[model samples]
Target: MIRSMTGYGKGEALSEQGRCTVEIRSVNHRYGEISVRMPRAFMALENEVKKALACTLKRGKIDAYVQWEEAGGCAALPAADLVLARGYAELLRSLSQELGLKEEPSLGLILAQKGVLGEAVAGQPDPDQCLAQLMSAVQGAVAAMDAMRRREGDALLCDLASRRGQVAQWVQRISERAPQVVDEYRQKLKIRLDQLLEGTEMDAARLAQEVALMADRCDVTEELVRLSSHFTQFDDALAADEPVGRKLDFLMQEMNREINTIGSKSSDAEVTSLVIRIKAEMEKMREQVQNVE
Candidate 1:
């Protein structure tokens, strides 16, 4: 099924080590681009996260945010380096004595030194163990996002279908009006010639020749035929199972080309009006196609 390129989704997983939450946001883009943001500890999994997203969300500016909260009991405890703290205290005392300072080095000063207290390395969760939970959460978020995109796509499909049908009707109107334009022009020409000649008889063969020339000059049969073919292709694209945004966009361009040709060939007001309306509808469909995937 088709999908829109804009959506939001979130998923979470809980384990003995921690809770992992993932949120994904996507917007329309011409190409597929994915970015991931996570803690430094999980940097190794960034590629995995992007791969997972790209597998489902094929075209968009996608951003994924990952948050990890260690379980209450699993949280890493800060460990004090007693040896480093002692060394800092000794250095401070020696500097104080050398400078003839009256105040002693406080315990706070020693503990505040760099590397004195830090998170225990052993307390960190294993990345291998966390992969399963992370992937599960990723899959959930993708499913949610896909559902939203599909719903939006359905709405797009309906709107496009309605506009396509309306354009086809106008094309039909133009085709019906084309033949009358030449006949009307012939009548107007003959009347003008009669008025100028003051009752002189007109040449029937010459008049027929002139009308034939006019009809040949203003013929839009070929353009209308191509437009009909483009409409059929547009319908097929909408019913397609895969991404057809580019295909639909190309068809819109082709339709516009045919409509422009029709407008230029005819001098009739009704045909020109129909051409204008068809162009307007094509613009709307073109804009909507940019969001399809």
Candidate 2:
């Protein structure tokens, strides 16, 4: 399915760690770019988030935001108390010497003493699990954006298809009118030559050769054939799965080249008018193609 390069989506997930929210915004861009914003605590997950988004979006200027809420189960980190530990160890040593005891207090017995160390009520969330949850939210957000982009692409495709069809019609009109132009020019040339040398001996073979050369110069058969071929390729690009904006733009240029050749080869007013209209429509299609992904 085709997808536009502009869209927005949001996703949220809840887990033992916290609530994770992901928001993504995208707009048309020639290359894929993703920028992520989140808390410092989750800064380590930026690369992972970008990689995850790359799996879905091929091209765009994507801005992603991640929000996290702490769960009640997590507790603050305990502050170590060096002063208290040293005081308790010193007091223990003094009591041992006064009691004539020779054994030294173990390191564990000092830490276990009251007021020496604080205990935690709950453990902090697992870094791995938190990252996993965040990714899940980000994936959901990308999926939502994909749906919106695809919907917008449907409209774009329909418009482009209609314009392509119109261009094809104009090319056909130019092709049919091209032959008549040379025939008309041949007659005009002969009349002009007769008027220039009235009652004088005119070389019939020379006139025929002149008319033949004019016809050859004005012929648009090759250009018409190439234009039709380009139309076929344009249709294929529309049906393609990957990004085709650049491809379509290139095809439009090729089509314009053929149209220009046809216009230059023929001096017919009708052909000029049709060529002008095709150019106008092609310009509009080009503007729309810029938004395609």
Candidate 3:
């Protein structure tokens, strides 16, 4: 199915140990580009996350953020630098004796001193478990992103289809009116010739030859047929399941070329107006195709 290049998704996982969250944001881009932000410990998982995202997303500028939180983990642990605390106490007592001070140091005074206690926590995270939880979060985010892309893609497809139908309708109208243009020109030419040759003998063969040549010069059958074929190809490309942005763009170029050729060859005002409308629709489709993936 067609996918849009813009979307947003978020995923979260919670366990007994901690909670993990992942958020992804994407925007239209010519090529796929992924940037990730996570804890230093989780940096090794960036490659895996990027690979997973690339598998699902073909083209976009994607940004991902990951965060982890541990509950009831750091508060219960006691400080580890008891030796530093004892050393501070011995020094304080010596200072008191040397100054002949009478006040005694309390636990609050010792705890308030710098380097008396350590705040660092000790524990190694399980790589396998962390990886599993991260993958789960990534999967959820991927699903959400895909849904948004699909929804936008559906709207785009509908609009494109409608425009295609309109162009096809214009092509039909042009085809019907094109032949009449040449016929009208021929009749006008014949009338002018008759007026110029009034009361004079004229060669019927020469007049017929001149009209035939003029008709050939005004013929747009080949261009119309080729334009119809291009329209068909464009429709086929739209219905395709894979990335069709490039193909649709190429088809539009061909369609525009055919329309220009027809407009230049056909001198009728009505045909020219129809060609203009087709060009307008083609321009809109071209803009939309840029966001498709």
Candidate 4:
């Protein structure tokens, strides 16, 4: 079944290390693009995350957000700057001695000195464990998003099918009206000739030749046949189990081309009006195809 490019999904996984949550949002795009936002600790896994999304989602502008809530996670780990702490202790002891103070520098006092305690550079403690949890969460989120996209795709398919049928009906009407147009032209031409030749005989062979030429110029049989073939191809693509947005887009262009050709060749007002409506329907289908995958 086809899928739409717009959807949102969220998923999570838990492990002894932490709980990983992922949220994915996708929108229509001409090509595949996946962007991930996560803590600096998981930055190394950015490419892998993007690859996984692209592999499953195929085509779209996808944004993924990753959140790792450590059973006791910190934006950054608290660290004791041992070197700084030692220096502060030494300086305090020297000052106490110089002042002949009896009191020793309290551990807390030394520890609280400037830069004695600080935060460590953020980094993954266990990359393997993080990756496993992250991948699991990402997979779950992808599954959810896929389901939503499919549901939307079904709706899109119905609309496209209905429009296709409408266009086909209009094409049929145009086909039926084409012959009448030539016949009407022939009749009108004969009447004009008769009026001009008042009391004189008109050339029957010449009139038939003129009618034949007009019919040849206005024939839309081949265009209609090709358009019908495109419709079949469109249906086949829709039923296929793969990304067919580009294929459908191409087919719409082709169908539009044929319709334009027919419209240009047709002189009848009725056929022209039908062409206008078909073109309108084709435009709507093309817009809908842009959302399919």
Candidate 5:
């Protein structure tokens, strides 16, 4: 199924120890790029997160963030090391008496020394359980993100279909007007030649040859035929189940090239206007294709 490169999803999982939240945001990119942010202890799981994301997404610049919050019941309390604090105070007092400084250090100054405090309040989480919870949250977030991508993809498909129809309409109009352009050129050439050779004899064969050459030079049948073929391929790629963004982009380039050539070769004002309209639709289609995967 088609998927858009832009979307957002968030998921949370609660446990007796804490609650974990995962949020993912993605934007259009030429290739797959994943960035993850989580607790320092969970850094080991970065490879796992990238593997999980790769299973579902094909292309985008994706950012994933994870947060963990501990409930009241799971909070840890801080404690000071009184023995270490006393040892430091005794050592400082002995040094002061030996140096004859006659000064006593403040309680706050003694407690501020390193190792005078026990371990930090918060303890390390159970690595295995935390990994499981993180995986679950990430899975849920990925599912939600896929849904949003699919929804946006549906809208893009509709827009592309409408633009494709417009391009087909313009191609038909150009085809119908092609023969008329040749006829008009032939008539104009005949009129000019008659005026230039008014008092001289004109060669019928030479005039016919000149008209045929001019018609050949202005012929857009080959370009129109190739353009129609490219349009068909574009539609087929859209209906495909796999990633078709790159394929569609290449087809759009080819289609635009053909349209530009037709405009340059066909001197008729009407044909030029039709080419302009087709090019405008092609540009819009190109922009939309950038978000497809």
Candidate 6:
């Protein structure tokens, strides 16, 4: 099944701790890679998220956004480290006594000390619960993205199939013209020989041998055969379960090689034109294959 490399999806999962929203966007790329953006709370699970994405996405530049809103807008208050604040306060009071400073160390002074104030961490959601929620949201988003990719892929495949048929027709035209090229060359050789010899008796056996050599040298049967085989392979790859982009690319290169060889060997105007036409179609298919996965 063909799949496209570009798509978008969004999903959400809710729990007692909060609501988590995950949105994913992907585009064509040579390799699989993913980046995530979310609140600091989810940073620890970035790798886990990537792994989950890789399970569904074969190749693409994926960008994900995650958002979490705590239930009821509840939050923890700033907390004080009592030991550190007490130690600092005591040292200040001692210094004040030794220096005969009139000022007494106040509660405000203790609270203002560095590291003395920090958030009273809220009860964290269970780790398992967080991971489960994350994976669920990720799966939902990826499923939606895959649906879009499949739809786009079906459309692209239709276009590619039509162009592939055109290429096949061009190949067939070249095949039909190949044998005639040799026969025409042999006939021209005989006419030229008769004119040069002023209508004298020509050696038919020698002419036949030379014509055979020309036929062998100019034959494009092998190239057409290989080209046909590649077309079959291309169709098979399209129906394959794995990503078919690279496979299609390699087959296209092989097809190019065969068509070029046919063009060089035939030396026929019509065959040459057909080769060029097939190559144009090949270029178009290449462009489309780049977006396939």
1-293: candidate 3 lDDT, tens digit per residue: 67788899999987776878899999988778999998777888889999988988878899999887674464434465789889888989999999999877788889889877666553435656799888999989989998999999999999999999999999999989977987887788878888999968778888778878877877889988898888888878878888777777788888889899988887789999998999999899889988887
Q: What is the TM-score of candidate 6?
A: 0.81
TM-scores for every candidate against the unseen true structure: 0.87, 0.80, 0.78, 0.84, 0.85, 0.81
Candidate 4, position 192, lDDT: 94
lDDT of 1 by residue, 1-293 (tens): 57899999999999988888999999998889899998777889999999999889888899999878787755457899999998998899999999999788998888789999986643456777899999888988899999999999999999999999999899998888888999899999999989988999899899999999999989999998898899899999999988888888888888899889888988899998898898998999899999998
Among all candidates shown, the one with the greatest lDDT: 4
Tens digits of per-residue lDDT for model 5 on 1-293? 57799999998888887888899999999989999998777788888988898899889999999887775545666678989899999999999999999889779889889989776565556656688888899999999999999999999999999999999999999999999988888788888988998968778899889878988988998998998899889989888887888888899999999999999898899999999999988899999999997
* TM-score preference between candidates 1 and 4, better one: 1
Between candidates 1 and 5, the one scoring higher on TM-score is: 1
Number of the candidate with higher lDDT, 1 or 3: 1
Model 6 misplaced stretches (Cα beyond 4 Å): 73-128
- The CA-based lDDT of model 6 is what? 0.87
- For candidate 2, write residues 176-241 as lDDT tens digits: 887788788888987898899997988999988998998898888899888888899989988887
What is the number of backbone collisions in each predicted candidate, taken in the order shown?
0, 0, 0, 0, 0, 0
Give the better candidate number (3 or 4) by lDDT.
Answer: 4
Off by over 4 Å in 2: 72-126
Q: For candidate 5, what's the RMSD?
A: 3.4
lDDT (C-alpha, whole model) for all candidates:
0.89, 0.86, 0.85, 0.90, 0.88, 0.87
Which residue pairs does candidate 3 place in steric collision?
A: none
**lDDT, ranked from best to worst:** 4, 1, 5, 6, 2, 3
lDDT, model 1: 0.89
Residue by residue across 1-293, what tens digits does model 6's lDDT show?
A: 89999999998888888777899999999888899997677788988989988998889899999877677767767778989988998899999989999798988888888989986665455555688888888888989999999999998889888999899988887888888898899999999999999978999999999999999988888888899899999999988878888888899899999988988887778888888888888999999998997
